[model samples]
Target chain A: MSLFHWLRKKLLFLTRANLFIAIGFMLLLAGWQVLSFYTHEILLASPAQAACALWGIIGTSYFNENFLITLWRLFFGIVSGGLIGFVLGTAAGLNEDIKNILEPFRWIMLSIPPVVVVVLAMLWFGMGSKMVAFITSVLVAPIVYVNTVKGIEMVDEKLVEMARLYKFGFVMRIKDVYTPAIIGPLGAAMVLITCMGARVVILAELMGANDGIGYALGVTRSNLDVPQLFAWVLVTLGIVSVFEFILLRPVEKHFIRWKL
Target chain B: MSPVISFENVVKEYGGRKVISGLSFQIHSREVVGLLGQSGMGKTTILKIIAGLEMPSDGDIKVIAERVGYVFQEPRLLPWRTALENVMLPMIALGMNKKQAGEKANHFLGEMELSEFTHYYPSQLSGGMMQRVSLARAFATEPEVLLLDEPFSALDLQMKDAILSMIEERLLVQPMTVLYVSHSQEEVMRISNRIFMMSSGSKLDELPIQHCRAFRAGCKKAFLKWTKQIGSN
Candidate 1:
């Protein structure tokens, strides 16, 4: 294909909703610029000032070190939680007795406040990244577990019956029938858990940790560095958006290509 | 020769509703037996019972065959699997190695005239094509007994004829006992050695097709008369 035509095709794939999102973000920047003009510089910095501050820290060792630490904690917590949740949820789906046993625990995990969990982790682990990781997993695992269980429950019963009649063993049935049925919902849950995990990790760090993005934010708050804080927040949002749209969306599309 | 399947006074009930009551029949080896019944007359239940997918509430049922192939009313191809994979499914499940199963599946798909569409997914195929793929899947296992539950009920006349011809050709090469279920008398009469008519809460009646084959015009007249009677009731 010609380069211009290829570019046009790619642009066409961007829906009107994406255009609206871009417009909305521009409006937010305009609003921020207006607020910064009205307010004291120390209280609310202008978007331009924040952008300059962001550039200053973009490649610095301080920013990179904190960002990498936070990223690592987020990844570890989500991966560990997602694995445990998927295994347990799938088991519950296959066996009614196991579902009954796990029902109360899932409910308890979902209902408990994340702040309380963080506090408990802090008390147990003595204020470190370990506690932050524990807090994030505790906060995110229940969402994954609940969604996975629901996904498995919603699988087509007729397909299961067909599998059984064809003498499909458990593994074959899972790979051929059950996995496809659940993958869509699990993909959706993974997206939710990743975003939620990032937020929870930052919150835990802000509360107690000495390192990472949350700690950096804590230091900026004490220093009354409004531009730096805004810069850090924007960077975090950019990372999450990249992870969600560029990475997870493509992976989800791959998993559900059969549907297309 | 022993019967391939026998149901001795089998009874099946669902939530106090008797779907099949005191049903007794024997399908002899290598015979194509058409089971004729109206909608919701428990014909499918009988097939399921024979396939061991459902158990009889009472009495004895015996299927002497080691392997049975079932073609459902709707083609139940796994949407995620391609036509070739769907055809290979049962053979692989029955412990055939992947290579042999692939060759067997390919041969059956060829017979069903689905060789060109082997890589297509179920969603990509037309209804007739999907049903043909389903037939290929059923025959790929090389079953001793084939149970067809209105397999052509959803197809148009031309598609139906094409499928019936394909099935007829397959049966000619390798004879197997078959229990063909359908609502049309003419369809059953065209293919079956014997026809069994079923009604709710009534004993099944068996009609041999040997004399009917000798007198084709007379058999058509009788089929029309029987259909009219059924319609009036």
Candidate 2:
């Protein structure tokens, strides 16, 4: 395909949903511009000023150091939480007794506020990356567990019976049936948990951590640099979006190609 | 020759309702037995019992076969697996290596005239094509006993004839003891050496076919005559 045609095809694939997202983004920008006109620059940064701030920080050592640290924390938190959740949830799905035992813990984890969990982590682990990672994982794990359980439970019984009739061993049944059955919901859950994990890690950093994008945001807040804080937020969003589109989306699509 | 399958006064019940009571029958090796019944008349229950998917509530049921192939009413192809992969599944389970299973599956798909569509997923295939794949999967295992439960009921008349012919041709070359279940009298008469009628009251009536001018000629003539008499009346 020609470059123009390829680009056009990609654009068309976005559908009406993309158009709505674009409109929402434009409205937010217009509102920010209006607010900046009415308020002091220190109080409300104009979209242009925030963009300029973003450009200023793009190549700086400060930006690179904080961005990398935050990315690392986010990655570790998501991976650890996701793996634990998948294992536990699959066990629960396979056995009613396990599900019953885990029910109370799942509920407790889900019900507790993220702020309280962060506070407890701060008290327990002290102020550092460990604390931030703990808080993020704790907050995200329950959601992953819930989604995994739902996914596994929703697998068709007829398929299971078919597998049994064919004398499929446990591993074969898991590979051919269970994995495909859960991939769709699990993919959606991973996307959700990752996004939530990113946000929570930043919150944890703001509360206690010494380095990362949230720390940078705190620094900007202390200096009354509204434009720079907004710039940091935008950068963080860009990183998360890159992770989602570049890594998760393709993996999800590959695993669930049967649905497509 | 000894009987390959024997159901000796088998009794089955579910939730206080008797589905099959005092059922007794024997299927000899290399024999094709057709089971005719209306819906919910325990014909499928009998197949399931023989397939070891369900148990009899009382009495004895024995099947002396190394492998049993079952073609259910609906083609239960794994939606994710392609036609060839679905066909290879039972072979792989039966201890065939991947390469050997793939080759065998390919051969069967070829026999069913589904060679070109072997890579197609179940969702991509039509109903008739899916059922053909299901048949190929069953036959690929080289099962000692084949159990079919209305395998072609979902197809059009032409598709049904095509599938039936495929099955008949395969059976002729490699005869296996078969317990074929269907609602159609004509179908049962055409395909089976002996026929058994089942009813909701747990009664089974046997009709033995006598060879005349051709295969199933006696049963076919009787079926045609019966249909004609009903039409005339």
Candidate 3:
């Protein structure tokens, strides 16, 4: 295709909303690099040191296993929590009795601090990947549930009436009405669950995990390996972003084409 | 012959209020019946009950067929879908292939004089145009009974007249059992074969349009006399 056509297609995808996200990230990166210059060299590694050191340590054996472990934990945790929460959320939305039963639990989940799930999981499930995964799942469930339920509540009642009048079956109703409305928040929830899952994995490692990025960050902190610690943080965050772009973005784009 | 649709001893209650109590009506085959009523007198509710959108609370309702196309009080087009796509939604909902559905929808749009606006979204259309698109969608499905709830009540006089003329021409060639709900007396005389005037939960009068037109204000012997008679009934 010609460059003109390519540019036009690119422009079609352009929106102020997503463009602002890119701009904000760039600004934050720049500010962090500039701030490093005025700070203590040991405490705050210069951007050059952080970048170079991070690159050098990218494939190092010390960081590789832990990072991979945390990644796996996050993926599984998010999937489990998101599925359960989605089911619960939809059921509660459809049935008043379910809503009455689950509303209190949902509120409790929302109000409690993140650490509470983490602490409780550690205590009950015992320390390891399993425990960390459990904590992450618990942390993510409510956010996904609440957003999905809210999306369901916003479906057009009149459209539903039209569906009934036509004798549209369950599959047809879902495809025509519910899918368009539900997918929006459901897509957002997936993104959130993924990020939150990563956080919980790291936090769980710090709390009790023997292997994962969190454990490495924890070890490096105690040993005053600030540069290495910063590198690990950067690498983990990079991994998260890469997965979101590669995996989640395409899925979100497919489902959210209606909004466009 | 049994009526095409019948509402027998219909008692419609909404949260302890008796909206339509012990009401009964019958519409025969190929007849266009106008439901003339004030707002919130349960005309839309009756349409819904017949459409099976809502089941009656206490009534014996008989609909001859399952195919019902409903035009809601408002045009409820999918904002995300184009005119053709919105019209094709019923076909798609019925499990028709997208390719076939689109072809059928395009045909209907052309028939409705909306071929140029097939790709336009509902938000882009004027209120009258939206109603036309909604009408096209309902008719596209080839429904057995087309239930219209004040479909053209939002249009300006010129636009409304043009639409009604189109409807009249179309009905001459291809007629469905139509239950057109409206408050406009002119619309009833123009389109309806039969008229049922709803008043305070009972029919003020149910008569042929040929007779009812004379009883209306403009051409009547005495407008005040007819209005007083209607008011007392």
Candidate 4:
């Protein structure tokens, strides 16, 4: 096909979802610009100012050190929490006694405030990355656990019977039946956890740690550098988007691509 | 002929309620048996017990087959797998590698007239098409015994007729002991070598059917009369 014709065909297949997403982003930027106009430069940085400040930090050693530290903490927190929650959730879902036993603990974990956990973790683990990682994992575990249990409960018994009749081994049964059964609910939970994990890690760092993005945000705040603060916020959001879109979304789609 | 499937004094109960009590029957080698029953008459329970999906509360159940293929009331297909992949599942579980299983799955899907829909997922297919995929999955295993529990209820007239003929053709090519459970008298009468009606108290009473491939109008009328008589009681 000619270049123009080929491009037209490809664009024809583009769904309205991307267009709507672009519109949403445009609206956000417009709102940010309007808000910045009404506030002092020291209070609210315009998008352009924030972009320029972000450009300034792009290759700085301070930015690299803090960004990598925060990224590692976020990574470790989510992985550890997700793994622990999946194992416990599967146990609780499969056995009534286990579910009953875990009920009060689940309630406590879900209901306890993030601030209280951060304070308690600070007391227990002291400051720095350890405290931040602990707080992130503590806040994230209940979300994944609850969703996993719900997903397991919703699994179709007919499909399980079919698997048994076909003599599916343990690994095949989990791969074919359980994993797909849980992926839908778990996908939504992962997105929630990703966004929440980013916020919690930054918050914990702000509260108890002397390093990472939250500490840098605190530094910019003390210096009255609103552009730098906004830049840090943008970088945090960017990190969340990268993990959500690049890592979690593709894995979830691979598992449940049969869905329309 | 030696019985391939024999259940002696089989009893099953769920939560203090008895579903099957002292049910005894024998299905000989290559004999296609049709089980007719109302909803919740333990017809499915009987099939489950034979397939080893459920245990009899009290009895000896023996199935000579090394493998058993089942088609449930619903398609019960893995929603994430395509039509071809769903059919390939049992063959792969039975130790056939991917390539061989894919070829066999293709052959069965072709037999069900689902060649074009091999890559279509369950959600993408219609109700009848999904059921056809389930049928293809069952037949692809080439099991020595096949259990079909109201598998055709979800299918329309044309699809049901085509599938019934496909089952008949498969039986002709390679005889396997089949227990076809359904509420449709015509369906049971069409394919069954021996027909059994679920009577009161979880018991089965053999009902004679006209042994003809064409299934004339008179035989259908007689079968309907018998069904009504049994149904009313």
Candidate 5:
């Protein structure tokens, strides 16, 4: 691999595709914003004004407060849900007796909608971080659990036997065999849960919380602050994409190079 | 030489269809034993039983070796790891420190002439290279007994020749005992010191290499004289 070839590989790997898409996105928003001009700009903010408001929102203390609240809830919910899902999923996947016992419950979790879980859970526990986290964790758990169970069930039995012959201990078995095996579906499942978890937290905030991006959006809406609402929406989108690109994508690549 | 592994009256079945019935063998040290049978005759299952992946229905199995290394019919290398990492898998499992495991893996990969491809993943390697990595992984364990399940059935002629000889050199140069399973009589003759013929339902006829080395004995008249006699009866 020469320097030129290396550079070319890097260039191809990280393309201008996202930036161009963003440009096209700005064009679409510009069109939508300009259309608002003819309608007296009642509900929609112009793209330029919205961009200015995006900067304003980021520069203000309100953004920091709301971002922190949403971030904390999502993180807590996902970690808790992922751990529980992993444990229960592995047990169900590996043990026939355990699967028999847990099959009905796991199926029930998979079938129930997150919105329903949130509404009922909010009524039961009240609208707060704990309630939201609990609901989001339930939402995340089934996806993780189902994906994990599906992953383990598809684990190449021949490799398991190979591991046995080598006498692979618990740690080595996970690192050497199971990690790569689980990472594919788990990667997809994590992304799904993260998206759902974030949305659930925002909904939890909108329902009753005093602070969060969702609450800020609600405040801006009632005040007819269209620009600020758009800014808040952009912030949420930024957090979602940034975490996706920065955190999950590379981790997925590291664990599942075959995917690349 | 004392017997280090034994299978007595082993019975194997799948959904009431008996595959190996009353199978028995005593494998001693310092021998490369070939298990030969036609497809679906359960040669692989016998190796699977000895490797402890599957248990016999009603039999006694005694293995005195500290570790048993196996090369599955499939490559079965961890797709995430390099060929070197895959080869050092057993050592890592046995809790050897990273330095020792890596050094051992590097040396064996070098011995197998796979130094250039040490960092390659299973997908990156050719079918032959993948099989060699599997072989290297099995041998790098330093186990007393190696169980191979048709390790070279997938390779082309050139790759097969190179890999089989590479494996032969590694095993022959060390105190490695192998219970190799293969469907090809040619493969059996090239590597095995003893051969076991398995027919339907666990009946075995063990033949020494000197007696059954068809080409070497120039029994061109009856290439598999020993195996045929039993099958015909």
Candidate 6:
């Protein structure tokens, strides 16, 4: 495509919502720049210093290796955990007995700290990607499970009765009724899980694992490279944003187009 | 002609309170039966039992229809689907392909005079429009048996009259066995071939009247007198 055509196409995707988000980001960056000036360089990195550090990190082979590792672990962790949660949650949502049986497990999972889980995971899986992924999945599953149960329970009874009267088959009931009813809640839960997943993965990697962004952050922290530490944090935030905005948001928007 | 629906001593209880006790009724194929009763008098319960949404605590209920359609009091359209899509759902459930379902949905929506509003969501539509969508959805399925549980009760008189006329027109084109439960005597009189009054005891008493497709002054007078008799009882 010509430059003008490409530019027009891109501009069509931009709306007032994007403009407001851009302005809000600019204001936040300005605030951070002001705050950095008030503190020592070693204590707080300026946005410029962090940006320079991030640019430098991106050029290195270490960045590619560690970032890929973290991304892969995050992908596997979320998929496995989310699937298990969805299946169990659907069962629990349908049957009171299953819900009751799973209640204590959900409680324990929610109540237990990530630190404790990381420590336990290390003992079980050893110092590797497995440990980090396991910890991430454990933290992610309960959130998804709880939201799924709530979503299913809140499906309109009248609609269900209508479905029954119409003799909707099992697959049709799931596709037309249960899936749509749960998508709203599940979408919100997914956004929450992505951010939470990123944080827990890093924490787990930092505590137990030998590679990934968390390990890189740990290395920077030990060397007192504040700008590099901030750079790693930026990269983590970028990944989470990509997962949420690029991946989840489009899927959510497609499913809930009627709302728009 | 064999009855399409037969209820034999059907009894239902909710938490030890007998809502329907030994209710018996039979509805033949293509019969449009209007059910009039006071609130909380098992009118809805009877429809539920017939629809198999609620199982009777005791008795044998036989519904021989291959397909049943229900127009609930509330417009229970899936909020995420458009008007046309909502009408297509039951057809899709019956294993119709998307193209055929879509065509049928469009035809039904057109019949309801909602051809222009086919893409509107339930939340975007007005209350009367939503109810019309519900009616279209029920009709699109080509049900052998249709149960209308006060489908127009939430509508205003003006909208109610328009929809009742649409229903009467649809039934003329495509006749189905319908058990219509409504509180409005005028609405019941306009649509029903026979009117049955249900009492608190879950017993049905058939009221004798010359069946009319449209509400007339003479039938209105007779309906008022029968309603007054019911009230007095």
- Which pairs of residues have clashing backbones in candidate 6? none
Record all residue pairs in model 4 with backbone atoms less than 3 Å apart, i.e. clashing.
Answer: none
Candidate 2: residue A100 lDDT (0-100): 98
Winning candidate number (DockQ): 4
- lDDT (tens digit, per residue) of candidate 5 on B178-211: 9888887777778888888877666877775556
lDDT per residue (tens digit) for residues B14-62 in model 4: 9988998888889999999999888888999999988999998888889
Rank by DockQ, highest first.
Answer: 4, 5, 6, 1, 2, 3
Q: Which residues of candidate 4, in runs, are more than 4 Å off? A: A1-27, B208-233
| TM-scores (chain A) of the candidates | 0.91, 0.91, 0.87, 0.93, 0.85, 0.92
* lDDT, candidate 2, A37-105, per-residue tens: 999997888899999999999889999999999999999999999988988888888789999999999
The positional error of residue B157 in candidate 6, measured at the CA in angstroms, is 2.9
Q: If the candidates were sorted by their TM-score against the true structure, best first, what order would they fall in?
A: 1, 6, 2, 5, 4, 3
Predicted model with the maximum TM-score: 1
Q: State each model's CA lDDT, in order.
A: 0.86, 0.86, 0.81, 0.89, 0.82, 0.89
Docking class of 4: medium
Off by over 4 Å in 2: A1-17, B211-215, B218-233
Q: How well is candidate 5 docked (DockQ)?
A: 0.70
lDDT of 1 by residue, B33-125 (tens): 999878888999999998889998998988998888889999999998899999898888889999998899899999999889999989999
**Candidate 3 chain A weakest lDDT stretch, 10 residues:** A13-22
* Higher-lDDT candidate of 2 and 4: 4
For candidate 2, the TM-score is 0.90
Per-model TM-score, in order, reads 0.92, 0.90, 0.85, 0.89, 0.90, 0.91
The TM-score of candidate 1 is 0.92
Q: Write candidate 6's Cα lDDT for A1-260 as tens digits.
A: 97556655789965667667877999999999999999999999999999999999896899998899999999888888887888888888878999999999999999998899998999999998999889888888998999999998999998888888878898888788988889999999899989999999998889887899999999999999999999999999999999999999999999988888
Kept native contacts, fraction for each prediction: 0.47, 0.35, 0.47, 0.91, 0.85, 0.91
Standalone chain B TM-score for every prediction: 0.93, 0.91, 0.92, 0.92, 0.94, 0.93
What are the runs in model 5 whose C-alpha is more than 4 Å off? A1-27, A34-40, A113-116, A119-127, B208-210, B217-219
